[model samples]
Target: MNKSNIAILVLIGILFSSCTMKKETMPPNILFIAVDDLRTELGCYGNTVIKSPNIDQLAHDGVLFSNHFVNVPTCGASRHSLLTGMRPISKDYLRNDITELTLTNKQEQDAPETFIHHLKRNGYHTVGIGKISHSADGYIYGYNEAPSTKQELPNSWDELDFDYGKWKSGWNAFFGYANGENRQSLKRQVKPYEKGVVNDTGYVDGLTTKLAISKLNQLKKSSKPFFLGIGFFRPHLPFNAPKKYWDLYDRDSIPISPNPMIPEGVNLKSLHESGELNGYKLGEEKASLNHPVSEQYARTLRHAYYACVSYIDNQIGHILKELNKLGLDKNTIVVVWGDHGWHLGDQQMWGKHTIFENALKSPLIIKVPNKYKSKSVNSIIETVDIYPGLMELCNIKLPDSLDGKSFVSILEQKNMQTDNVAYSYYRDGISLRTNRYRLTKYYRKEEPTIELYDHNSDPFESKNISNDNKEIVEKLIPILEKGNKEIFY
Candidate 1:
């Protein structure tokens, strides 16, 4: 063989090796951020009133999903679906507190080998902060606390600097009451607002943000590829935040709900009439109205919620900036999502647990580094899709039992159709949302009552055309049937 031929072969081999190394090194690190009970109420999601600059900026940098619904609206069910990559109905697990659900034979106690466990097993340093599970208390989920192990309590709880008895964090403190039904007990303990103080001064969201920042700094120094899940507990309930945040907005300026005042003679569904407000009841309808909230009071509550969101956004911005400073932004994939939407006075409701869009629709923002930059996807995506989607984004080998399909194709192709309908189920009710239509069937076996709304025509879902268009209903019935078959089977 000639020396020239041998040299040419060696050059080709070097080029191939370089290309392979580049491809292998391209796998980006993931920064999965999950918020509790947040709705699609930001500037990016066409919410002009709410101030979420951090989230809006993140959306501008990457992709903001227009339509992202959770499998279930409640905390436990939604998180279970998101973590496990399966629908709540399919798993037959729809309640909070893994222990109670398991004891009552309602659902399984352990998480079904979630994406986090998968990542951990595959050599990613996984750490969860704040409320990742139904319970804010970590012991409920088998972390840090065990009968055989010594309990190393944080200094904050030991010193009793904060009102541990009243707030979720404080409950393990001096005044902790695990069985208490009234959340107002904690609400009453919070000081209206104070400036420049860390201990017992700010809301839980602020505390969570501070802790998350600390975690980020610690993780940055570590050599391992980390999966940090920072869960923010805010805009959820009690409507508490720093008084300054509440003071930011004028009460009268807060916009009234798009569908304010539930219409007269609107059919009372079993969900509403059941009198369970899905778990947390702000108050009875008559009581809420009789003690009619003044415009000032309404504004105050809305202002607090908005302030909490802004606070969260600010924290997120800080984290993102840190990621950039550490040169991790190039390899980190950031996903900011709300567990479910909250009802800020829509249909006379104030909390999640309803099957309405206001309650079920959550904001899903994904930043896939240099590879997937400045892309917006409008495909129908469920919370269950998050697991597989992350798997594909990180190029991880996903398990075959995953119920979700990766929407990575949709990221590349804007108009990709992963599924014809995004299905969501709550107890007996099932909802199917498509590009142009939303059809919901309330019951099984019996003639399923359907409500059809053309999303393009009526974005607010004001008018139900199910009764008016018999042919459309008939046509959609089979589609709904097919969707349910997949959802249940």
Candidate 2:
């Protein structure tokens, strides 16, 4: 009687314990990839010229947003707003360089909270591979350190030293005084070398990708969730990539920009007056138009940019492969985004200072495992939304101070509307890109001009329809005024 009773009791206890034990659910890992100065010139974005097979494949596999823009166009300002989930207008970060933009030195230390910090607090191991937040304090931003407990990646540029002065100014060896005056400048200027060249052995994009691959491999064995930020610095200034990439495109095949030269008699007085176009030195219209940049040179530049993009994409593929190999792809959320769009000889402009669609739009791709797959969202989304979107995707509590709303619903539905208008502000101009229209208003007292483009009819934004469509202008004027009144911080 005693043996039978004891055996029955033990069996009953074991069954009850099995039913009550809590099953551990691992939190989804995040693969955050950021590219510097990348425009919507990829194959997925309908640019037939640039070769971005890896990125195009990613878009095909995941959800790609047709219209995505950044808070600001510059690096530091854009990154600051992106990390803090605030607009450049709100943070007063109107320009590059954190020290010059943020007034107080202590303000840098007590800056707005970042999504990375939030992830770290939520038991996720945060590791920033490269160019995450300008790397002010090495420890805070994860620079000059080995990969975390999550993974290990070899540092390609750890031993290399960068000569910023020689790189930017291009003097053989220039020395500056204590007051920041140039003491001596050499006569011969050093030519800028492309990446993968012997001189550019320490390319930032290559180094960053190498490190990221290492981290991805190491994270395979970790039990804790990880947030890996892989930032690629490419297609920016100094246009650097491997020589092979430069040879990918045919010289004559490289198409010239539709509006390569600015029209004659069209007044650029406003741009010149604003001091914004100060150093960009505009030559005579005839000279500028007649000066022949050989097809070879044009092809070379295009090839370099495209090659850098491919390089980044290859690295991304490597990381994604590692995730799949580690059995993490099922539980991981991957987001690939470019900071802002770049101009390739559009409106006679080369860089991204202007508020054109080519300069504003960015590539935004999100893959949320089994939940959100094979979806394409055409809604206009701002970079600010990334902060809240990540929080919602991971089911993490978002900070109340964040100004962005989670557009997680848009990921499911192709035509979901989170906001009626997506806003982008430059120094004195505010651009409101709605579903079908884009309106830009210059806030100059003397010459407050308005430029409007009906994207439905004019996707290329060639004609300024503001003057012609007076009725539509009247309809959108009130909305634009209201948006201008609302602070974007």
Candidate 3:
């Protein structure tokens, strides 16, 4: 062959090699949607009642984890575990203010504070909207106090923003009512639920949705892979939504928890007086462990919560549609996760500060381009695993300090070799959840410090057979204690 002909062939080969390399080297964009106070009671999780069509469709297009649990059940703590990939190593780590206390006003350094910071270090543009951290916005403020210029995550986001709109402050908007009045302004005199005659833009979530859609449009033109975190306010508190979303559900058909009474063998110390729900002074009635709310009132509160879920679902639909229209869905890794689960009259409780299954289980849906399709992973996974999982999914290098092991294999191969266990911490108790059992141990002076519930016969956790199941407790305590790095006792 002539030298000129060989040189031309070599150039063609080099061009082909680069074309292949481009496909492998281009990193995927991340669309992370974190909802507050959500649980496994959605249409995608086999709830025929809740009108969560958008989220259900997300499950249809990607992977849904039916057995996912959080390490902590509160908003700030659970998200801390999620963002940092660490379990409750210290009692102080379980506080909602852990992020603000540990990370605020810090200088930049090589060691990333959170996983989002890690992504930022790796040449990704991170944008945050709404309550990605403990605060409604990224700013620091008390519920009744003025806002400050401090960041909860000091080095995480490139642009941290929240559109409080007419409410004037992020905290006010979070606990807002329809008429621009909020719980703080009203001195907590307002009811815990509201149905307003406004469009989707009537609430802050609507504004957040608009902002997210606009961000997606702008992000499509960026040169670097973007990590966009869109956090929604509802289904969290005050149960406020446009009247249209509320009107979608029939009040009579709203289902309350089947196991509404206290479990058979548990002490009253394990439960509480629904302190969080009772904070709204004008609530129809307070929730208590001894005297549970009436069935009729329970359905009413549940109805309001369903409305908020539908409202948030619509907001998610808007952002997802924008992503697809901008062609970002083709290379974007989308995640729909709830910070933690709320108790809608489970065990006669109305909050998430419990070590039960209902409080710890939340919805987690992940969609990767051209990978798993319409899949459901029932093996137990925890909130701590999300950081490592995302790192592996985005082809980024995994950090050795993360507490979670990657479940990316479980995303593809349904029946891979693995241990299906999840651990949760609340109060003085440490709990473990397996495929068929839930074991909890409290470090206190109580007769029934150990609680065991077999999910096979009682998925609602209505009965505790710890005394009868001593052998099971003996077998699972070591596994549970392994996760309790800092023992309370």
Best by lDDT: 3
lDDT of 3 by residue, 328-347 (tens): 99999999999888889989
Query: How many pairs of residues collide in each model?
Result: 5, 2, 0
RMSD of each: 7.2, 7.6, 2.6
lDDT of 1 at 399: 77
lDDT of 2 by residue, 1-489 (tens): 799999999999998877555212667888988887788878888888777777787788788888888867766677766776876544256565542234223322333247776777678877766555543211121322322221111111111112222222211111111122221231112112243542222344544556666777887777678888876666654455665666567656777666555433223422222122122223112112334344454455556567667666666777777778877888788889888887665555556756667778888998887775667787778888899998888889887767576778777565488454776767566777888998877676544367788888767676676777888888877777664644332
Better of 1 and 3 by TM-score: 3
Measured against the true structure, the TM-scores of the candidates, in listed sequence, are 0.78, 0.77, 0.95
Model 1 ranges off by over 4 Å: 1-26, 98-112, 141-201, 263-266, 270-297, 444-448, 483-489
Clashing residue pairs, candidate 2?
A: 151-218, 152-214
- Compute the lDDT for candidate 1: 0.64
